[model samples]
Target: MAVIDLSKLPFPDNDLEKFLDSVCETHELDFAAYAGMNPVTQTVHGFVNYPQEWQTHYVNQNYVNRDPTLLLAKRSIAPVDWQRLRQEPSFDMVFSDAHDFGISDQGLTIPVRGPFGDIGLFSVTRKCSAHDWALLKAKILGDLQQAAVHLHDHVIQSEALSSVLGPPALSAREIEILQWTAAGKSQQDTADILSISHRTIEVHLRSAREKLGALTTAQAIGRAISRGLIYPA
Candidate 1:
């Protein structure tokens, strides 16, 4: 088997409309939009850098709270198809919101949840023939979900998820060792807390340092604390 490189791959890291642009290239959609948000805060937080007028109008009117598509997506974990929503009278207000903002009535949104506390939506908007939109929606939903998931994971890790979760690192065993170490546990005590042996605890600690890329046990302790892997007393 080929070995996988542990080094980080360089991604765009931040580009608005990356997901939408990607889907547009492959699909018939004319506009691609993205929104990275804090679900708990009920704020858009960030979007794919749309026009200033669009942003200002969206915020000034508080459309998200009134957006039927967002409400449907949140209530259901699965991808909520726009065509399905359009037929529901409860969501007819969505059309009003779109019209108010001068947005196309045709669009699909995919919401993605990820580790380290990340959530976002990827959407494709089009003002095109009905047949074109049907084909575009069919071809693009799966890709939009994948892209949204990727961007969510990227945001959670890079954007200081200390507000929620953080740094998807280590394992339960590593955390047990680190906690004991922080409590001034001897290797013997660490092993005792974990019902293992001192040598085993040492192995766990060494593995944790390597896994956390910490040069010292103290550094490991600090890193774990900051990442919410271990709570401070």
Candidate 2:
């Protein structure tokens, strides 16, 4: 199976079309789309590599609210295969029009949960037989999941989105402690370096974890780095 090193991809800015195009080409997919919901604002932002005509038609018809793929994927922890949604009426309603644009219903949608309450859905489609689609999905599913997380992080960290949803607030002491921890220093070492009591370090670390919505100090460091709040040691 092919492994995609999504970390090497450029971080997305306002335009995600190029990023989606690269994902499709790398994964041998026909089309790629991303939809992310900001829990704070309850607004959905999307990007797609589909034809412009279809894009316009989807919006004109107000399909965003009724698309089964998006609805089902949003509620699923695992990737939602188009096969599973084929029996739904909304599936036909959306894909019947999609077919007119030379698109196929052979697709998969992966959902990524952010540390915050945000959610991102990454969908890819291909025109292929059921057997071929199954094999393709099996081979690329892991990479697609990685891509989903990468895309979600970059999207939520984008300047446009950050402007609306402010980045996690970490105080100076909290950041200092996290930096030391990321540098492989023990809590005692960090306390000694800062000339503070070990209990103070613990308090700051706990606060940092809560602010980043991280379950552990290590996860907090990773989330901090991904959000450009701290650098990797």
User: Per-model C-alpha lDDT, please?
Assistant: 0.64, 0.82
Q: Which residues of candidate 2, in runs, are more than 4 Å off?
A: 1-15, 159-233
Q: Weakest 10 consecutive residues, lDDT, candidate 1?
A: 1-10
Highest lDDT scorer: 2
Model 2 reaches what TM-score against the true structure? 0.66
Model 1, which residues run further than 4 Å from truth?
A: 1-13, 17-20, 39-42, 87-94, 100-102, 116-118, 162-233
* Local distance difference test, candidate 2: 0.82
lDDT, candidate 2, residue 116?
A: 72
Per-candidate RMSD, Å: 13.1, 9.3
TM-score of each: 0.55, 0.66
Candidate 1: C-alpha lDDT: 0.64
> Candidate 2's error at 178, in angstroms?
14
